[model samples]
Target: MTANRELDDILRRAADGGRISPEEALLLYTDAPFHALGEAADTVRRRRYPDNIVTYIIDRNINYTNVCVTACKFCAFFRAPKHEEGWSHPTEEILRRCGEAVDLGATQVMLQGGHHPDYGVEYYETLFSAVKAAYPDLVIHSIGPSEVLHMSKVSGVSIEESIRRIKAAGLDSIAGAGAEMLPERPRTAIAPLKESGARWLEVMEIAHNLGVESTATMMMGTGETNAERIEHITMIRDVQDRTGGFRSFIPWTYQPENNHLKGRTQATNLEYLRFVAVARLFFDNVAHLQSSWLTTGKDVGQLSLHMGVDDLGSIMLEENVISSAGARHRSKLTELVSMIRGADRTPAQRDTLYRHLKVHWTPADDPTDERVVSHFSSIALPGGGAGGRTALSVIDAQ
Candidate 1:
């Protein structure tokens, strides 16, 4: 068969819910026509979410500490063990952030941070439990397999035990941090000290079995090959086939700024959208795919809704990691609702588990919480501090 025919066949097969191999995925990524590829992926999305409703979460990424031992080359967020700038939030400060998130209509709080050597599983347990005790309703979707692995090594405990302790301490779910690119070459080149890609998956699998579900993420750009990109998702697909645990797959571009790996490479808009289409068509088992507007910008994020993106990840009340790496896009709750509505899909506020909390069926009924803004300069300061503004004061300013 000719190349066009083969591409059409693969697209048709995938759109119809048939699983595509990594090789086939690479072909679609590199050779398939963009519009056709997107349509096929859209077909798959419709199959999964027939209601044509797009979902978003209102959450805050509370970076607990900047003192990291595993200094990733692509990271502009972490500080060395005792860097003068390094800081870890006190439990009261963390609780304050959580309170801010709740007041802004956020349903979840992602406790993102670096691997501080001093922090063992006990640290997370204490923090998570404290947050839960303060706000029992806020979903504590924090950390990932990489952090879990690091904690296990630090605390001299098994991986399973670490996850169990955190879960018992009220870690609702794991966010997909530390999954830069889940292949040997890129993973090692970017984050050499972090756990292996396989080990990352293993930790996630253990979390799934332990009844603590999580999400899968991929950091694009960072000088990875096209084949390696496909390999990354394929690895996640293989694991998803086994455990059926990953709640979503969020692939975002690498923001290179103020970091050691600055401008070495970055995924373009076309590359990001094509990969989103390809990932949706490829992962038959994963239930949701998120568009990372934090790194990719809002226009592409809006475009992704039709390209098999079911979730426009959080109208993040605060995000520091990507913002620290030069991601400048900021969004508001009403603006996000308008974007989803403009895309011809009903916008719904969802919880961590993808359950719809509220649906905006008409423009007049859309939410109007001005305080639910993305990383404002005054808010997402360095070192996970909530800057000098009190949450309510910020709200009053709005």
Candidate 2:
């Protein structure tokens, strides 16, 4: 068959609810026409959502520490152990942030931070228990595979034991944060000290076995090739087929600002949308495909809704890691709703696990009564800017 016919056949098969092999996915990524891919994927998206409407969630990303033992090359957020500016938030401060998030109508808190030394599984248990105790309604959808690996080591516990302890303490789900590039070579090249891609999946599998669901993510626009991208999604899809524990798939561009990979440009808007659409088509088992407005701008985000993304990510009451890496796109509750509505979709506020909390069909119908504003707080560095203090605040209105 010709290339166009081959692409058409793959799209047809995918649309007819058949799975695409990794080789076919690679061809679609490289050879499929942009509009053709978008149309095929959008068809699948409509079949799943059916409502011509997209959605978004409102949550806070609470980074509890920046002091990291594993130094990933593509990261601008983590600080080295002796960097003088490395730090961890006290448990009280973490609770205070949780209280603030709850007050702002945030139903979910992404408690992400670097792999801090000496912070064993007990530390997370205490923090999660305290947060849940104070705000039982707030969803603690936080941490990732890398942190789990580190905690297992620090506490001398098994990965299963560590995950169980944290879940017992109130971790609702694991955030797929450290999945920078799931293919072996690129992941190792960028994050040498981090857990292997297989190991990361192993942790998620263990969490899934423990009845904890997670969202799978891929850090795109890095140096990985097209085949590697498909490989990443295929790996996740295989796992989902077995465990059915992954709730959504989120692919976002890598911010190449402050870290060692500074010379590389971030993925373009077109590239991001293409991946978003392809993910919808490829990951047939995963239920939700999220459009990341945090990395891609709002216009691209809006476009993605029709292209295959159903969720527009979060309001992000607070986000520091991506911002520190030079992602500047910011959206308020009003603007987010407006974008979704403008695209002829209904915007919904969701919890960490993608459960629909509230749906805003129109601008006049928004349920959030709190004012939105941005906070300005700093993360203390031991020596001071390389290890310098980085202050971050959330956009809130009150």
Candidate 3:
């Protein structure tokens, strides 16, 4: 049979509740027509989430340190230990950001940064504890596998102990940030200094066993083959089958600017949509599939909603890493809701843990007329101004 026929057969079988073999999944990823794949995946999404609405979260990404020991090739955000601009935010700085996030109506704070050498489990314990003490209601959804391994090595503590200490301090959920590429060969090629692919999953498994749930992410278009992509999802699906601890699966394109991999480009919209559809079809054990608006533009993000993505990731109050890598698309609560409604889906505001906080069926008739402001960094705000800078910067400059 032709590749298209085979993919159709496999998708039909999957829709009928039968499992598709990995070989068939490879064909679906490579040969299936875009609309066909999206339609089939949309069937699955509708069956799972009968409501015709997409969701997003109000959150902020607070990078604790730009000083990283593992200089991943695809990362434009990390700086070496002795780099002139390399810096680590003190606990006070982090808390201040958390305060800003809360004030901006952010429900979740994603604390991510490079793996610093001197900072270990104790650093996280102190930081998380302080954040929780200040903002008890904010969800401390932070960290990734790379940091987990580094913490274990630096502190001479076991992975379980590291997770336990962080959880005790205030980490409610873990963000699967360091999972750029999960296949051993491709992962090593892209981020050799980081933990091995297997080790990344191993730490996540340990965290899951210890009652910490995390979202799984895959950074595609990093020179990995279609087979490698399947392998990445298969690995996460297998782990989810065992632990059932992954709350969602998020796959985004690799940004290729200001990094070692500067010559490369991100995956095309078609390729990204195919991956999102395949993720929905293959990972039955994973509940949510999130579309990356930060990496992909709003149009692609809306297309993803039809291709089986239930979540639109986040309205990140402040996201520096991807911005540093040259991702320029920005969204606010008003714009995000309009995009979801334009796609014939309801727009619901969700907390970090996928709990629906507010659902909007109609677009915001009048946009918020609050005074536009700029942060010290070049963050593309909803109203076309920078945001998140300290008042001191403005005063000192004057």
Candidate 4:
């Protein structure tokens, strides 16, 4: 078949670490046999990371404010600005949360949230500075282009300067939180109020040029066509080709439990795994591809290591966003180590920069850190923690 020849060529080129076009990527993503695709992708992964180590980071996703202006339909985490139930965590409260995370062995704190109307560059500068001052060792992996654009507009400055000010105030790296789909159709359909895909990449380009590295992310299963998914990867690859600032690319499925989109157009587990493999094959320039255990459950996360992922993502000590949307998966540090080992790869704890801190070779020598549990369920926060975490601050119904 003509299709078979095209796919065969594509897989050969891909396995050889050669670049494939968007069209070719789509063909492989949709048409190739699952096992065949996984084989090529795993080859690429081994070639890229030959160390045979599967990595994970210990961090806390601190949502500074649930009050947001650009309310995406797929979000159940954010409350509209001025809504009675909306609230922002005071600076000290955020610091306390960070302190708790630090005490529990978190080296990085992901400060992500809704675009609060009042928080501009200065607001972030002060917060980031304080977090760095209090815990100079904590990597402030916070904010992406969407928040940069919002803060720039709020402060009446350019995005470059916004990044400059935040970086100066100790924003060590950026988190690719707001890049929902990157393509116009699915992006607008889900989050019309957010910045355009081009604009997101533009801001990241500026960040990359400024020596500030960042990770990129995608939220799939939100009614996007296979072609659109490939388009998203292509857009990211083009940007990575120029800047080389994206440290990793993370793709997660959209949860439809409590969001406005309401379970209408979610990607299946098969599609998620396929994209993970396709991303590995496509993003040859990017160094790391992470598998999301939070959204897709543990089995897929383990399988992703064999497919294409070198990183198991963060052992989130505190996560409210995805948990709010009904992602209930959780694990401890030992559990994660076991998962990686079971996948036939050495388990390692990595920093924000993907530098391995500790690598385990033998199962008998595995770590026994009881304190390093996945704090998603039984988080030590007040108001009953993440499992029953309602809101950091909520207003009276009146």
State residue 105's C-alpha deviation in candidate 3, in Å: 1.1
lDDT of 4 at 350: 90
Quote the positional error of residue 35 for candidate 4 in Å.
0.7
For 1-398, candidate 4 gives per-residue lDDT tens digits of 12488788898899899999888888888889888899899999888778898999899888777788888999988888778777676788889878878887789998987898888999999999999999999999998899999999999999889999999999999889888899999999999999899999999999999989999999999899999999998999999999999999999999887789998988888999999999999998999999999999999999988788999998888787887777878877888999999999998889999998887878876888777766543222333344333444433322
lDDT of 1 by residue, 1-398 (tens): 23599898999999999988899999999999889989999999999999999999998888878778898999888889767778777888789878877888889999988888888999999999999999999999999888898889999999989999999999999988888899999999988998899989999999999998899999999999999999999999999998999999999999888899987888899999999999999999999999988888889999999899999988877777887888878888888988899899999999999999998888887998676677642234443333344432121100
| C-alpha positional error of residue 219 in candidate 1 after TM-score superposition, expressed in Å | 0.5
Q: Cα miss at 261, model 2 (Å)?
A: 0.7
All candidates' lDDT scores? 0.87, 0.80, 0.81, 0.86
Worst 10-residue lDDT window for candidate 2 reads 380-389
Query: What would the per-residue lDDT of candidate 2 be over residues 1-398, giving only the tens digit for each residue?
Result: 23578889998888767888889888877788888888888889888887566767767788888888898888888877767667677777778877766777778888988788878999899999999999998888999988999999999999999999999999998998899898999898888888889989999999999999999999988788888898999989889989999999989888877889894756778878888878888888999998877777789988998778888887776777877777777766777888888888887877776667777766778755435422223232221111122443322111
The C-alpha stretches of model 3 lying farther than 4 A from their native spots are 1-5, 364-398
Q: What's the TM for model 4?
A: 0.94
lDDT score for candidate 1 against the true structure:
0.87
Off by more than 4 A, model 1? 1-3, 377-398
Point out where model 2 deviates above 4 Å. 1-3, 367-370, 373-398
